[model samples]
Target: MDGFPEKILLATDGPVSMGTATRAAVDLAERGGAELHVVHVWHTVPSPHARGFIRSGLKEIGQDKLEQQVREIVETGGTVAGAHLREGQAVEAIVDQGERIGADLVIAGSRGMGRLGRLALGSVSTGLAHRSHCPVLIVPEGEKAWPPDRVLVGHGSFEDTEQAGFLGARLARTLGVEVELVGVTSESGDAQEKLHDLDRELESRADEIGKVVGTRPRVRALVGNVPETILGLYAGDEKRALLSFGSKVLGGAGRMMVGEPLDEVLNSSRGPILISPELHPASKSRVPEREQDEGPQRPAVLLATDGSEVSLRAAGYAARLADGLDAKLFALYVVDEYLTFRSGVHYGDFIKSLSENGREATGKVRALAEEAGVECEELIVLGRPDRAILTVAEEIEADPIVLGSEGTSRIEHVLIGSVSEEVLRNANRTVLVVGGHPEYARPKGESSGVG
Candidate 1:
C-alpha cells in the first residue's frame, strides 16, 4: 500500500516567494522515498526569429534558481531525480514536465502573507493548480516538512472527498502520524452537545478512513465560518502539522474542480496542503471498493430558503438533482439571527415571526421534494444565515449546498441577505445557486404569515 508519489515535481521560480513549498517538498520526498524533480521554469528562451542577446541572462537566472534547489536538497538529504530548466509559461512548463515525468503530484507555492493580504493564491500557483495534470499541494510559508506529527483532513460528503480522506489517512499511517477529521459546526443550545453530536455523526466516516489508513481518526468540530474555522486549526504550533483535503480541479481526467474554499485555505494558512485528485486515478473510481457494488451514490443535496418563490424554485432544482442522484434532499430554513441582533420593543416580535416563517418555508420545500419523489429532511436553525447554513451543511455533511441566488428584499435583509452568495463563495463542496435574481420571490408579508 505504498502509494506515495514516486515522481514528485517541485516547481519554483526563485527563493523569495515560494512560501513553504520548497521545505515541504524536500522533507516529503526524503521521507516518502519519492524521487524529486526540482523545476525552475523560465520564459527567457528566444523565439525562432528573436535576438540571442537576452538568452544568456535568462539561462543564468534559470540556473541560479536550480542551484538554490540543489542546495536545499543537499541540506534536507532529499534525492533529486532531475533538475529541470524549462522555457515558456511557468505553469505550462511545470504541467507539461510533470505529465512527461509521470509525476504523481506537483508541489507549488501560494502567496501566504504576501501583498494579497494572506488571502490570495499566487498567480503562477493558481494557474498551475487549475491547469495541472496531477494534484497540486500548496504550502503557504517556508517551514521544514519533517516533524509533522499530525495530519488534518477536511472532511465532507462529496464523492471527491472520499479519495481525499482515504489518501490522506493512508499517508498519515505510513508516516506514523495522527489523523484528525476537522469540521465546522454552527449548532445552537449547548456547546458540549453540539461537539458531541458532530463527533458522533462523524464516527461512521472516521471508521472508513481508519480502514484505509490502518488507524481510527479523531473527529472534531468547531464553531465559526468555514474557511476561518478550518484554518484556525493550524495555529502555527508546528507540532500538529500538514493539512490535507480533496478538491475538484479543472482540466481533463479528474473532472473535479477545486473551489473557493480551498483557495481561501491556501491563502490564509501557512501549512503543507495535500490535495487529492478528483478522479482518484490510483483507485480508478470515485467511491470505495465496497461501495462500487452499490453503484454510484449521489451526494446529499442541501437547499437553503427564505420561503420566497425564488427559493422555492431553487428547491425545485435541488429536488431534481436529488432525484437524479437518488439522494436525500436537505431543506434548510435559516432564521437569520441578524434580525434579532438589534434590541428594541419590536425584537421579540421579529424573532417569533422569523422563526415561524422559517419553519413554514421549510415545510413548503418538503412538500415540493416529496411531490418529486425525493426523500426530504427539514431543519431550522437560528444564526447568521450564511454561517448557519455552512454549519448545518457540515453537520449533515451535505455534498452540494444548493440555494436561491438571492434573498429577501428588505433593504436591511438584502444587505444582510447575501447569505446564499456568501455560501456559494465559501462552501467546501459543490454549490448550486439556482436562478439569476430574487425579484419574483415571495414578498415580506409572507414573514408575518400574511401570505
Candidate 2:
C-alpha cells in the first residue's frame, strides 16, 4: 500500500466551518470508492441518571438541523457507510467512533477566516489532530464554497517521506491535478543528499501513484519556509489548492507536537491541511515496551552548522535531542560563497578558505553527536547557506533540523531574516530553531490544527 486510506470518517459539527470538510469527504469517498462514515459529536454524554431526566425535558433542537445536513449529503450523490451521533468529549468520541469502524482518515473542520487576527478553531478539531489514532484532514474555513484544483503537499524529511508526502502525491494522481511536493529549507552546505533523496523518493511515489491514476505525476521541491513556500505556490490559486501534511504521532502523547514549520503555518493560515500520523499506530515512536526490541524506531535529526556562536549552541541541543530520541544526527556545514564580500566574482582563495571552515564546523558538530552516543553523519558542501541546510536535511530524511535561535528567528518578529528564521519559514518538516534559553510564544490568533 502506498498509504492512501481505505476508510474515511468525516467528523462534523453543525456549523458553517464544517462546510469544507463535508464537501471534501464526500468527494474523496465518492472518487476513491473508499467507505465513508460521517459522525457528529455534539456534546459530552450526561450521567445515566441525568440523561433520562434531560432526555424527557430537553428539546434537542439540533436533531432537526443534523437530519437536514444528512439529507443534503445524501442528495449530493454518495452513499454513507454510516452517519452516527454520539455524545462525550468531541475528540474522544470521534476517535472512538472512527476506530469502531476502522477509519483510515479523519476529516474535520477548522474555524473559517473571520476578522483579522481572529482564529477560532473549535476545541474538538484541535484535540482530534493531537490524539487521533489515524490520520486527520483539517478543512480550512470557506473551502466548502470552492472545489480544489490542485494538491499542494508540504513535503519534507522523516516519516513523511514515506507517509504523508507519498500519500499526498498519490491523492494528486487520483485527482488528476498538478502535485507540488514542495520543500522549504534553510541551512548552508551540501544539499545534494537532501535533493537526491527528494528526487528518488518523489520519483518512486510518482510511479506508485501512476499505477492508480494512470499517469505519472510531476514532483518538485523549492527552498523556503514550509507554510509560506506552500502558500506562495498557491498565492493565486489558494482557493483551488488543498494543502496536505503529515501529523506528529511519535511524540507528545496528549499534547500537540507540531514541528515549528507547521506551527507557523497552522496558526494563522487559512487552508485545508491534510495530516496523517508520521508513523502508524503500531510503529515504535511510542510503542509498548514489548515492541521496543523488535525494530529500529529512532528518527534522525539534522544539525546545520555555520561555526557561529548560535550554530554551536544548536549543535549541543541537537546532540541532546539525538540522545533523547535515540536518533541519528547529521551535521552539515555550507561553505557560503554568498556570504563572502568578493564571492560575487568567485574568488578562488576565499572560496577555499570558506570550504575549509565549513569542514571544521561540521567536524565540531560530529564530535558532539558522537560524544552523546548518537549515530552521526557529517558533511560539508559548497552552496548558499539556506539551500545547503535544507537539501542535506531532505537527503537524510531528518525528522527535525536543530538550530540555535535568537528567539526572533522563527517566532521572534524582530529577527525576521536571519538563517534560523529562513529555515523555519521554509522547512518542509519540523524545525527546531532553539533559543539559548526556553520560552513560550504563541501566534497572534487561536485556531485549530489547520488554520
Candidate 3:
C-alpha cells in the first residue's frame, strides 16, 4: 500500500525554528531512504503600487532562507534532493508543491504555544494538517529529536483509523519500535461492555495490520473524555513517543479549522505529531473496509495505590495481570482530600505532601508496567481515595480494580469506609485485594476461587 514514505516535503517559514523541521526531515529521510525536498513559501505584496519592488525583495529573502535551511540540513549530514522557493500564501503553495511532487509525507514546525485558546499550531501548520493530501508531521519548537521510540496511532472514524494505523505502523517499523493503536470513546452507556467490544474490534484490526505490516500492533480502548483520555495516554515522556492520528475533515463548504480533539492534542502535546488528513488517498485501496455501528472499546486494569509497601506489591501484580491479559494498565493515585482537610497540619502543606506522595505512587506503577512491557496510563487526582478509585474504574471501564489489603493511616481510612469492604459491596466489577498471603487471596470480581 506504499506505507513507507519515499518522498518527503519539508515546508518552512523563515522565522520559526526551521532547524527542528530540517533535522526531523533529514532523520526520516535517512531512515526510510526517502528523497527530502525543502520548500519556503513567501508572502506576496497585497498592493499593486509597490508590488514589483516589494515582491522582488521578498523573493530574495525567501531564496536566502531556503538556501540557509538546505545548508543546515547538509551540515547535519542530510542530503536535500530539491530546494523550492515559491511566492503565494504559505499553505496553498506548500500543498500544491507536495501534490505536484507526489510527496508521501510533509514535515513542518510549529511555535508550540501553551494555552488552549492560543494553540501552538500557526495558520500554516494547521492548514497543512487540514488540507494536505498526504500525512503531515508537525514538529513543535521544543522537541528534541526525531524517530521516536514508539508510535501511537489514535483511532478516529473507520477510514481515518485505517489510514492512520497503516501509516503509523509503517513508521514504527521503519524506526524499529513498537506501534500501539488506541481508541477513546465517550463516557456513556455500559462503558465496560463498550470497552470489551472496542477491544475485540481493535484486535481484529490489529490482526489485519499484522498481516500487512509483518508485526502485530498492541491495541487499547478507553472510556472517558475523548481528548483528555487520549492526551493523558500521550502525556509524560513526550520526546520519546510520536503520536500519529487521522485529522478528520470538518466544516462544510468553507475553510475549516483543525477541529476538536486534534486541536486539543496539538495544544497539550509537547511532542512531535503526525496528522493524516482525511483526503489522504493512499489507504483507500490498501486497507480493507469494515462496517461497524460505533467505535469499539478495549479492556483496561486499574491499580489504585497509596505509595505504601503493600500498594507497590499490588502495582507489580497489576502490571503482570495486564501483560498477561494483553490489556492496558491504568495506574491511579488519588490524594485524599477528606483526610488532608481533617488533619491538624496546615492545608496547603498537607495537600502538597499528598500530591508528592501520589506522584511517587503512580510513578512506581508506571515503572512496573514499563518493565513488564505493558501500556500504562498514570493519573494523579485529588479526592477521597475510594471514591476516586471507583470513579476512575467506571470511567475507564476497568474490568478489575487492584488495591492493597494493608496500608498507612491514609489507606486505613480507605479500608475502614471505602476500599476493601465498601468497594466490594458496591462495585459491579472485579476487586483484587492483595493481602499478606497473596497466594490465598481470591479476586472478588470473578467466580473462580483461588486457594
Candidate 4:
C-alpha cells in the first residue's frame, strides 16, 4: 500500500473553473497511473409542488452532460476518467461522493469569483479543500495544470532546514526533479552578520542532505522579507515550480508562540506550497502517555468554515499545506448559535441548512483531493463556532487547525470576535491563521507577497 493512492477524484461544477480543474486532474492521474472519477454538482431550485423532485431531475440531466464531457476527454487519449453527478449544494455532494467511492485524492479549481459573489455564494473549492480528510490539490487560475516538475524549498530554522532538505531531496527523487534550497533572512537593522551566518549554516545543511539523496542541489541566501524573498525566487524565470517549507521550527510550542509562517506563505504564494513538520528528539523516546506516545503525525489539519468568503479563502492555504505534508485533511463547518437566535429561525431548519452548506464545501475539497490523488475526510457540526471546531478536532485527534483571519486588522482583532486568535491561544494543537482576502485583486506591477 506504499504507492496505492492511484484513484483520483475530480470535482466540477460545469463552469470554467471546472474545466481547468479537470485538465489538471487528468494530467496528474496520467502521471501517477491513477484512475479518475469526475464528479459534477448541480444546483436545483425547489418548487412548491414537490420537495427535491426538481433537484433530482436536474441532477440526472447535469450528470449526463458531465458524463459526456468525461467520455470525450478520456476518448481523446486523456486520463482514464469516469463521471458522476449529484444534487444539492456543490461542496457537500462532492464530499459525500468521494467518501462513498473511497477516493485516494480530490482535485478542484479555484473559481475566479469576485469579492461580492464569493462572499454570498462562498467558495466550494476552498471549503472542500480544507475539510476533506485527504490531500486536496487546488489548481489556481492562470497557472500550469500539472504536478510540479521543479521544486523550491524555503528553510527557516536549523532543524527545520535540515528536515526541509531531507524532504526536498526525497520529493525530488520521487518526482525526478531538481530541488533548489533557499534560505531567507529579513534585512532588519543590524542583522546582516547574523543573517549571513544563518545563510551559510543552511547551505551547509542542504548540501549534506543533497549528498545523501545523490542530487546536486542549488543553494541561495537572500536578505528581505522571508515571504517576499521566497516568492521572488520562484517567480523569477521559473515556469515550472512547487514551493516547499518546514511546518515549523520549534514544533507545537513554536507554532503557538510565533504563529504560522507557512500559513502566510500559502496565502501569498501563487504556486502550490508543501509543508513538513519537524521531527523532534522527544519523538524517539518511548512513552506511555497518549500524547507523548503518539508524537506528531505529519501535522494533520482541520479546516474550519462558516460558509463565508474569508473562511473559504483559508481553505486554499490549508489544501496546499495538506498536500505538502501528505497529511489527512478534514473540513469542518460550525453553526453558531448567534445566527439561529438572531434570525428567529427554527433550530432544526438552521442546522439542516448549515449542514447542507458544509457538505457542499466538503465536496469542493474532496474534488481537490481527488485531483491531487490524496485521501481526505469531511465533517459538519453544530454549536458555538470556536467550541464546535475545537471539539471536532479533539474528537478526531487532529494536529493543526487552519482558519481564516476574518479580515480584521490588528485593532479590530483585539476588539471584534477573534476566533482564530482564540484557537491559537487555547488549542493544545497547532493553529494556522490565514490573513488575506482572496477577492482582493492584485494591482498591476504589484508583487504577491511571496518572499
Candidate 5:
C-alpha cells in the first residue's frame, strides 16, 4: 500500500535532457523496491543508398553510447535494471518495449529543443505518452532534482471533485506534506457578493480538506479569471506544489468534450497536476468493494496544448494527474493542420517547431511531476486539433482528456470554445477543460469569453 511505483520503465533517447529522468527512475526503483527497465530507442532516419549506410552506422554508434549510459544508471542501484535498444519510431518502440516487459510505469524526459529540432526529430516522449499502456512519468531536467513539498488539488462543480479531494488528501499523506485546496468561482455577481461568496466557499472547502487530511490548509480565494487566477497564485508563491484535479466528460450535440475548469487549471499551473476521472456515486460510498483489485487501473488523461498560455495550463493539469493516478500522461499538442495551412509558414519547419515546442512544454510538465515526486510520459502529434486529440485518446486507451477552454467568438458567457465544442461532440473519453483567467474579475452580466 506504499505510494510509490513498484516497477518502472525508463525510456530515453540518450539526450542530455534525460539525465534528470534517469536519476528519478533510479531513485524510484531503489526506494520502492521496483524494477527498472531502461529502454533506449534509436530512430534511424530512412535514407537513400550510401547515405542510408552512413545513417545506419551512426545510429549503431549512438545506440552503443546510450547503452553505456543506461549501464551507468543501473549501476547506481541494486534493483533489476535492464536495457532495451530498438530501432523504429521513438514512441512506437517505447510502447512496444513497455508492453512486452509488463512494466507498471513508463518514465521519460522532455527535450526543450527549439522548433527546428522538434521538426527534424519528432518528440518521442509525446508519442510514447499517447501509446503507452502503463503510467508514464516525464521528468524535466532541473526539476527532477527537487522533492515535492506542497500538493494543489483543483476542485470544480463536477461529480469527480469529491474523489479528487480524497486522492489529493491521500497523496499529501503519502508525501508527508500539506495540501492546498483551490476552487475557482467566476465573478458573475456584484463585486461585494462575489467576494463574500468566494470567501465562504473557500473557507468551507478548506475546512473540509482539513478534516480529510487531518490538518488545516491555507485557503486562497482569489477574484479573477480561472486560469489566470490559478497561475497567479502559484506565481506569487515560491513553494514547490503538486496540483490535483478530476477529469469529467461533457457530452453535447453528439460530441464529447472534457470539462473546462480542469483543463484551464492544468495548462496554467506551473506545478505538477494530478487528474482523475469522475467517480460514480456508488464508488463514492467509501465502502470496501467485494474484492480489491491490485492491478493498476488505466489512468487516462487528455493533454491539450497549442504552445499558448491557455494550452500550457492544460499540460500542467495533466502532469498533476500523472502523479495522482500513477497513470501515463499523454500530451496532445495539435498543429491545427487547418490553421497551419493558413499560417503560410513552411509546413516542414512549422510542424517541426510545433513539435519541439510541444517537447519543451512537455519538459515543463515533467519538471513539475519530478518536483511532486511523481513519474510521467508524454506525446507529440500533428493533425487537425479536435480529431487529433480524439484519435490519440482512443489509440492510447486514455480514459480522460484534459483541455483548455476559450470562447470561439468575442461573446461573453461562452464557457467553451470551438475546439472544445468539437471535442465534446466527438470524444469518447471524459474531458476536462479549464477556462477563465484567474486574474481579472468580470463584471456581473459581462461576457466571459476571451476578450
Candidate 6:
C-alpha cells in the first residue's frame, strides 16, 4: 500500500522566498516515500513585437529557478520526479500541472507574489486552496517543517469545526502526530462560565471526532484574540506545531460572519497552516426565492463494497454520511477480470459465481442505505475494482468514494483488498478508507479482490 503522499507537487514563485516551501515539500516527500515535482510559471507584460524575446528570457529564468530548487533537494538526498516551467498565469499553470500530475498535495509559499502584486494575481497559496482538487499546504515566509509534532485544529462553529476536525485527525494519524481541538471565548462579565462552556464544547467535539477517526484528541480552550490565541500557541516552536481550519474562515463574507478574529488569522504573518474546503461560503447576491430555499446541492457519496465485514461497516458509515449531508448513495461492486481469466478451465463457472457475489455485495449496501433513509442506486461492473470505482465516481460526480481498507480473505482476491489504496492514489477527489491498517497500499497491474 502506498502512503498518503504518493506524489507531492511544489509550486515555486522563483528563487526568492521559496526556501520554506522547498524544505517542507522535501521533508514530506522523504517521510512519506513520495515523488517530488516542482513547477514555476513566468509571463511577460503585454507586448506584440518583443514578445518572443521576453518569452525566451522568462523561460531561461524559470528554468534556472526550478534547477536551483531541484539542486537543493538532490543535495539533501531527496529525489526529484520532475521540474516544470510554463508560461502563463501562476495560479492557472500551477493548478493545471497539479491536476495533470495527479498530485496528492500541493505545497507553496504563502507570500509567493509580492504584497502589491497580489491584487493582480491572487495570492498563489490562497488561489491554490480555492482551486486545486488536492490538499494545499501553505508554508509561511519563515515557517519550517512538514509534519509537526503537534497539530492544532482551530474550532469555530460546530459544523465547520467538525469538518475541519475530521480532516485534521486523518492527517494527524497519517503523519503520526499529536492533535488537539482548540476554542476561544471572549466574554468579560461571565468569563469563568464561558470558559467552562467552551471547554465542554471542545470535549464533546473531541468525542465525536474519536468516534470517526478512532483517536480522541486533547482539547484546549483559551481566552484572548481568536487569531492571536490560536497562532500564539506555537509561536516559539513554529516548526513543531501546525494550525488547521476550514477555508470558510478565510473567505470574504465568511470572515464577517465568523467575526473580526478570523481576519487576523488570515493577515497574521505566522503560519504553516492547513485549510480544507469543506465549508465554502456562497457569494452574496440577489437570487430567486425558489433557488434560495433549495440552496446548493451536494454531490453523491460512492460506496464500494465486496461483502466483507469491513465493507459492511463502510457501507453503514457511508449511508449515515449521505443521510446527514442530504446526498444520494451509490453502491458499486466490481467483478475482477483477473480472477475470471485465472479460472482457466472453469472460467464460465467462475464468472457466474463472481457475478452472483457482486449482486449480493451491492444488495447489502442497498439495504444499509435504505435503513438510513438515503436514496441509493446499485451498480455492478466487470473490470479492475480501482479503475471502475474512479470511472464511476467521475461519471456520477461523486465527492467522496468510500470503501474498506482491505477486502475478503480469498487467495485469488488478496490484491483486491488493496484497491482502496489504488483508488486513493489516482482519484482526483477525496477517498474514505474505513477500518484501514497501519500501512498504506497500492495495487499492482494484475488486480483481483472482493473489496
Compared with the true structure, model 5 gives a TM-score of 0.51
Best by lDDT: 3
Q: For each candidate, how many residue pairs have backbone atoms clashing (under 3 Å)?
A: 9, 14, 6, 39, 58, 6
What are the Cα lDDT values of the candidates?
0.68, 0.63, 0.71, 0.61, 0.58, 0.70
Question: Clashing pairs in model 3?
Answer: 113-120, 195-297, 198-296, 198-297, 199-297, 430-445
Candidate 2 structure quality by residue, lDDT tens digits, 263-309:
44554456667666754342234345424655654577888766766
Find the 10 residues in a row with the least total lDDT in model 6.
249-258
- Model 2 residue 84 distance off true place after TM-score fit, in angstroms: 1.4
| Order of models, best TM-score first | 3, 2, 1, 6, 4, 5
Q: What are the per-residue Cα lDDT tens digits for candidate 3 across 1-451?
A: 3568899999876543345666788888999999999998887768758888988988899998898888878877889999998888677789899988889999987653344212323546755765576789987665464657888888742225466788888889988999988877766888788888888888988898899888788998888876678667756444477888775432111112223466566656667788875632111222233113223344689998877777888899999999988888988777664574366654334545666676677888899999999998766555556666776676566889998876766536456335666667778899998865343346778677557
What is the lDDT for 97 in model 5? 89
lDDT of 5 at 54: 78
Tens-place lDDT per residue, model 5, 1-451, is 1234556888765654336667767765765577888877665565666887877797787678577766677567544467787776666677778878887667765543466533323345434433444445544446622345776766553224554565566656656778776766677668567666766876787787667656566665556676677777667877776666554321110111223344344333445544444422112122233124444344556576655556667667777777788776655555444444455554434545555666676666666656766655555545556776777676556767888775323431243377788888887778888776443347789876878
Task: Kindly give the stretch of ten consecutive residues in candidate 3 with the minimal lDDT sum.
Answer: 250-259
Candidate 1 residue runs with Cα over 4 Å from true position: 16-20, 45-50, 111-121, 144-147, 157-160, 188-198, 236-240, 253-259, 280-451
Q: Which stretches of candidate 6 lie over 4 Å from their true place?
A: 1-3, 16-18, 111-122, 130-133, 143-147, 157-163, 170-176, 188-193, 211-214, 235-239, 249-262, 279-451
| Candidate 2 least-lDDT 10 residues | 250-259
lDDT of 2: 0.63
Ranking by lDDT: 3, 6, 1, 2, 4, 5
The candidate with the higher TM-score, 1 or 6, is 1
Q: Which candidate tops TM-score?
A: 3
Q: Report how far residue 360 has shifted in candidate 4, in Å.
A: 30
For each candidate in turn, the TM-score is 0.56, 0.57, 0.57, 0.53, 0.51, 0.53
Measure candidate 1: CA RMSD: 12.5
